[model samples]
Target chain A: MTLSPEQIIKLGDLAKLAVTEQEASTLAVQVDDVLKYIGRVNELETADSIGQWKDTVVNTNVWRADEVRAINEAERNELLASFPSREDDFAKTAPVFKR
Target chain B: MRANLTIEEVQNGLRAKEFSAVELTQWYQRQIKEKNPHLNAYLTLNEEALATASLVDKKISAGAKIGPLSGIPMAIKDVIVTQGIRTTAGSKILENYIPPYDATVVDKIKKQAGIILGKVNCDEFAMGSSNENSAFGPTRNSIAPDRVPGGSSGGSAVAVAADLCTYSLGTDTGGSVRQPAAFCGVVGLKPTYGRCSRYGLIAMASSFDQPGVLAKTVKDAAIVLESIAGPDRLDSSAKDKPLKKWAAEIDQDVRGMRVALPKQFLEEGLNTEVEKSVRLAAEKLTRAGAKVELVDWPLLEMALAIYYIIMPAEVSANLARFDGIRYGMTVGAEDLWSHYQQTRGQLLGPEVKRRILTGTYVLSAGYYDAYYKKADLAKKRMRQLFAQQWQKYQAVLSPTTPTTAFKIGEKTTDPMAMYLSDVYTVVANIIGAPGISVPGGTDSQKLPIGWQLMSAPWREDQMLRLAAVLEKE
Candidate 1:
């Protein structure tokens, strides 16, 4: 159940986070501890029928009218203004691809 | 004199002209200024609170009819967005983010003329058990300054306990509202999932997260629930049922009702005083003609393990939205990937990062079936087990937390120790049941211990009625 430093770094990368070497080492141990605890879930006997039972307990695929509603212009502007970088009513971001 | 009034009493006072709304708001504002430095309960006070109160006062003077919550001042947890206010969700990432629209519950409160006091501090993104996880600072327990206020809704609990506001709004994913209320000596209610709209709550574990109420009394919590609970087009999960009158049902007798006390919760790791107080509270219920029976529910023991896996998995998916391009913190970098890495890595706190990492690991390619899928099936089994219990028992009773509030920094270093504090409360969230924590009694240090009562889905009326019996005792 223990995680290696490389695994921790890989997880951070997958999660879109950057982990320092120190953090990776610390998180390696902590994540291992948490995973060890969560390993108890393996002891529980789960059946294939449980998936069908889950659907009975939960409601899904709720549908609403497919009608267009105008967005509040003021609210939309406010949301746009909240972006860290904005350009002409759109959120700006760092270049996705660099040559 | 105004500081100690309950929500009902506040309404009565307003109707009787005992105090104007503006005067009441001023009292709370003054109290916050005086007490908040030590408590760290409030992160940001609403600058327009006085103006809103004045408007309520004018309406009253003009003979206009006021809503049920008219002029009652209350604070909201930082996780719930408040328009025009800096809603940080107790994270450095959202330090400067101001929401443009109100959360559905906030809008409902405003329409009822509930005066907004401020946004209270919480654990970052409502992730931690203790308020210690807050990036700002830990909120001190109102009774004992050195002891930590149980969290992630610690500030909301403290505000109500200290009479800084009539009531406060908080969110409970696991034990955020109820655990803190147990520590701070107030009433906290986590309604059935989808009872209140989640339209503006900063998402935590989306499946478990629900808006909750922390108030001075059970009736006050019920009143707030009645005010905010209903169908909303904004939150698809919100139940489309006719709203029940929760406050009106508070006085209903619980005579002859059957309640189950799960034996598992009363076993190991439980504080002796907390156990004794909860048992005494059960005795009181029995004396009042309710049948209190001890039941063995071993499936309950697996709740915390299941929660850690499933909750983090959901947290990973929900928090993936916090990239640099959107509303939160941003760091300029040469590439988009580095922008995300630098912003989140630099801005999110340690506990949050841990959760994200664990979440990603479980949902990762190799471990998905072993961890995430198994946890989901376990959750389903747990739900069915609870349903069977509900058929026999009217409600379940347990200690809200394993122990009373631990001293500050006591359990901060040990994440597992902090996670164990929620063992008793997480079941309610996993099963999507409504639960409440009532101030049962106090320990040797006079720290409050709460007795928790939970009922089947959408049965908040029954849950609150049982809580009312405890409140009367």
Candidate 2:
């Protein structure tokens, strides 16, 4: 149940987080404690697992008409105003590749 | 012995012309001004609150019929978005972001002419059990300035407890609303999941997060619930369910109602004084003519484990949308990966990152079946266990939290200990049942203890009625 530093670093990358070495080391311990605690979920008997009963948390898909309605003006402006860098109507971001 | 004004009292006072809507708004504003410096309950003051109050006053002067929440000031949890106002969810990432649209609950409150008292503080992204994790600052318990207000809805409960606002809206993912309410000595009601629309709530754990109410009375909680709870086309999960005159109907006698007190809730980790208080509260219900029995529910012990897995899983996905490309604070970098990494790493707090990493680890390629699936199976068993319990008992009761509010810095460094504070409260979210916390007797330290009642899915009426019995004593 322990999280290795490598796994923590890999998780940081997978989560798109740039953790400092200090923070990663700290997370390694904290996450290990949490993982050990949640491992107790294995205490539930395997016979009564999801194999017998279907997971009920899933809801029926929401189907709707494929139509575009007019967006509220204030809402559109507020959203556009939050962009770190904007070009016309697009939310501009950094270059995806070095090339 | 409630000190704050309830909705009915506020309504009656307005109709009697004892105080104008403007005056009421000013009163709460003054209270907030004086107390919030030490309490840190309100993060932002609504600049338009007075204007809204004046509008209500003019309508009253014109002899126009007013809405249910007319001129009643309310502080909103920072997590629930209020249009044209900044909704930060107590995180640095959303510090400067103003919501484009009102959350459905906020919209419903506004439609009824409820005065907005502005947004209250919370744990960063509602991730922590203690409000100490709020990025701006932690909110102290109004009851005991030295102790923590149980969180991540600490500010919401504090506002209502300190009478900064008549009532406030909060969200309960694990124990956010009820735990804080218990610490501050108030009524907190978390309605059935999908009862309140989640359209604009800053997502924490989409499956567990529900906008709830913290008020001076269960009746007041019902009033807010009636105003906000309904299906929304905006969130399809908010299925069409029958709304009730809960405020009006909560007064019915509990002559033959069946209630069960889970034996494990009092076994260990529960403070003896709090345990005794909960047992006494159960006795009071029995005296009120309800049949109170002890029941065995072992799976309840594993709720926090299941919640830690499922909640963070959802949090990782929900928070993925906060990349710098769209909104909030962003740090510049040459490459996209570095851009995202630096933006979130710099802006988000440690607890946020901790959960995200844990979620990433659990849902990673090889571990998904072992961790996520196991938790889901546990959750299914929790649902089945409750469904069986409901066949015999109308409500299940427990102490809202293991102990009274801890000292502010006591558990700050220990995430596991903080997570254990949610042990008794996470089951409601796991099973999607409606639950509430009412003030029980206080501990020897005089910190307030909370009594909880949970019932079947969408069966809020049963729990509300049972809470009314507890409130009666």
Candidate 3:
């Protein structure tokens, strides 16, 4: 269950997160610990149990009534104002990957 | 004025000219202003409440049909998005953020003519068991100021218990609503998953998060529930259960009601006073003509473990939207990635960051099947056990929390200790069923303890009926 720094970095990237070196190191250790603790679940004898688990029964993707409206520019800006960075009235701007 | 009158009583009062909407709203506002300083229950006060009260008054004067909750003042949890009002979710990241749209419950609450008193405080991103995690500061228990008002819905529960507002809104995922309600000596209901819309309400665990209500009494709890429960198209997972005719069913006797008590719940960690109060409440119900039986559910023990895994996994995903780039307090940095990391690391509290990290670890690809999937399987096992129990018992009984409200910093440093507070509350969320926490009695410190009553899916009406029957005493 031991984890490496590179694996932690890969997971962080895929999850759209930016992790610090300290966090990555700490998480790698804790991840190893938690994995060792819960490892027993994999050996449970319920492999052949039917109807033991289920996907949620609920359905989805129903459309709604059509409507168009305008929001006040000032009010909208108030919401956008809390963000740390923006450019040209849009959220900006670092590439997801090193090019 | 009837100090403890229910929502229905208040409506009848308005009809009989006993009190005006303006007067009621003003009374509540005064209560908030006078009492909230000690409780720290409110984050914002509604300036337009009086204006809305005037409209309700005009309707009453013109002999128009008034909404059920017309002019009834209630507080919204700050996590719920309200149009043109700052919705902080008790985080510095959104400290001044104003949502452009109202959450579904907000729209429904407003439509019921429920006067918006203000927004109440909560845990940062609804991630903590006690109000201490809130950026605004810990909410004091209505009955005991020395202890925490249980959170992340602490303010909602305290506001109701303290009589600052007739009722208040709270979001429950893993017992945010119920545990606090228990601690503050109020009634809190976490409806069935998707029973209410998540539309404008911010996400914590999309699969488990549900907007619930807090009130001083069970009947009052039903009043808020009826106003907000229904199919909400905005939340794809929101169920289509039409709001039941609950008020009408409140009078139905629980003579033949079947109550199940899980024997495992009274285990080592449960407090003696909490167990005694819960047992007494159950005895009171049985004396009033209901059948009570001890039921065994082994899966119940694994609920907290599974909840910890599933909830944090969802937390990491749900909180991903909070990067400084789009819509919250963002700390600036030289580049985009650094900006996201710095803003979240700084803006989010310690408990929130802890979950985000833990969640990221479990949901990470290599670990997903072993941790996340295993927990999901355990969740299914618990749900099945619940379904089987419900077939035999109408509702399940347990202590809402293992203990009464702890001192503010008791478990603040240990994340696992804090997670233990939600032990009883998370089971309902895991099973996707409806549950309510009613004020049982006070502990030695005079802090309120809560007793939980759980019912099958879409069976809120039955549960409310039983709660009303018990509350009569």
**DockQ values per model:** 0.74, 0.75, 0.35
Better of 1 and 3 by DockQ: 1
Tens digits of per-residue lDDT, candidate 3, B1-473, equal 55755677788889998999999888887788888898899998888899999999999999999878777888899999988778999999898787877998899878867799899999988888888989999898877788888889988988888888888899999999999999888889999997888888789998899999888778777877787877866677787766777777777888888999889888878999888888898898898798989877766777777888888889888888887666767676666677666677678776676677678878767778777878877777677677777887898889999999898788875566778788899998988899999878788878888889889989998888878766666
Best by lDDT: 1
Q: Kindly report which residue pairs in candidate 1 clash with one another.
A: none
Candidate 3 chain B, run of 10 with poorest lDDT: B332-341
**Runs off by more than 4 Å, candidate 2:** A48-51, A55-58, A72-75, B1-3
Candidate 3: where are CA atoms >4 Å away?
A: A1-44, A49-88, A92-99, B1-5
Q: Against the hidden true structure, what lDDT does model 1 obtain?
A: 0.91
What TM-score would you report for chain A in candidate 1? 0.79
Where in model 1 is the C-alpha error above 4 Å? A47-59, A65-67
Q: What's the lDDT for residue B331 in model 3?
A: 74
Q: State iRMS for model 2.
A: 1.4
TM-score of structure candidate 2 = 0.98
Candidate 3 docking quality: incorrect, acceptable, medium or high: acceptable
What DockQ would candidate 3 receive versus the native complex?
A: 0.35
